[model samples]
Target: MSGYFIYASLHQGRPALEIVDADSRQVCLQWEYGHSASQQTLPERDNPAVDELSESEIQRLFRRLLLLSCRQSLHGQDEPEQNS
Candidate 1:
């Protein structure tokens, strides 16, 4: 996966961060959100034609993205208890 291309793809108004290997297969490290999107900075989503940033920058971005997803999932877990 060293030469794999990591890209942000959109489908049905959602955002998906994909890593495709040299064989054009989704090898590993895929990220996505249902009903949400990939943002450049904030309040935006799905930059399909964006250029690739630095590796360090991408690492930082993905770390933040994972953290946010965890927080959102925790929030959703609380909803069932509240409704009950």
Candidate 2:
């Protein structure tokens, strides 16, 4: 794990955060968030991408996702939460 890039996109029609191998452009990990549940997947590897990331890096990624989610809510893209 030399370096990785984090970005936001839609995975399976839901918002997701993705970590990709900078050199190979391979998606090393994905975290898809939905209304009901969130899914995290680590692609097959001896050392997972998440393990390579520092604690600060992981925090920053989560912060970025939070900001994106807030922006979506402001723009009315996010659906209203349903009371269970």
Candidate 3:
């Protein structure tokens, strides 16, 4: 079976995301958004052309990251308005 896994956490105090192959545990992609993204990044010592993804794919990934970040930020907060 073909599968994959995604993980997100802080790396050196910066936001880090990784996509790994389930079978080989190889990281297919790694992104560190940091405080801002001023340049494009590619897998270390790897050709970016071979791993190029569509624009939509990148957008979708960004959306997921935003959602996850929001969730993490709200992890300990209380929403009294929702109680009503």
Candidate 4:
């Protein structure tokens, strides 16, 4: 039988998820959501809007980042609301 597990990743200190399968002597897996997103068949960048942004967009991103920093706790954990 197969088992599923949801783990809150602590590597990148960002929004991350992991699902592990269990049913064999040695089984492990990680669906790297973006191993090479930049190499996608389409021309769109991984984060197209961020990669190609105007002055206003850049400022907006900075503002958001600042807001997030403020909401983050001492444990490096940010409130769910501040996460993407």
Q: Who wins the lDDT comparison?
A: 2
Q: Which scores higher on TM-score, 1 or 3?
A: 3
C-alpha local distance difference test of each model? 0.52, 0.58, 0.57, 0.41
TM-score to true structure, per model: 0.32, 0.34, 0.38, 0.29
Cα lDDT of model 2 by residue, 1-84, tens digit: 345588888866656677775667887566654322332444344655535443444565577667656654675645665699
Which whole-number lDDT from 0 to 100 does residue 62 have in model 4? 53
- In model 2, the runs with Cα more than 4 Å from the true position are 1-53, 80-84
Cα lDDT, model 2, residue 8: 84
lDDT: the better of candidates 2 and 4: 2
What 10-residue stretch in candidate 4 is worst by lDDT?
A: 27-36
Q: Per-residue lDDT tens digits of candidate 3, residues 4-65?
A: 58898986655677877566788766766422353354334365552443344466567866
Worst 10 residues of 2 by lDDT: 34-43
Per-residue alpha-carbon lDDT of candidate 4 for residues 1-84, written as tens digits (9 for 90 to 100): 434454655444332344444434332333222223443222345656534433344455456446534543443444353556
Instruction: Output the lDDT of residue 56, model 3.
Output: 40
What is the full ranking by lDDT, best candidate first?
2, 3, 1, 4
Cα deviation at 12, candidate 1, in Å, is 1.1
Candidate 3 TM-score to native: 0.38
- Which residue pairs overlap in candidate 1's backbone? none
C-alpha lDDT of candidate 4 relative to the true structure: 0.41
Better of 2 and 3 by lDDT: 2
Q: How close is candidate 1 to the true structure, as a TM-score?
A: 0.32
Cα deviation of 62 in candidate 3 (Å)? Answer: 4.9
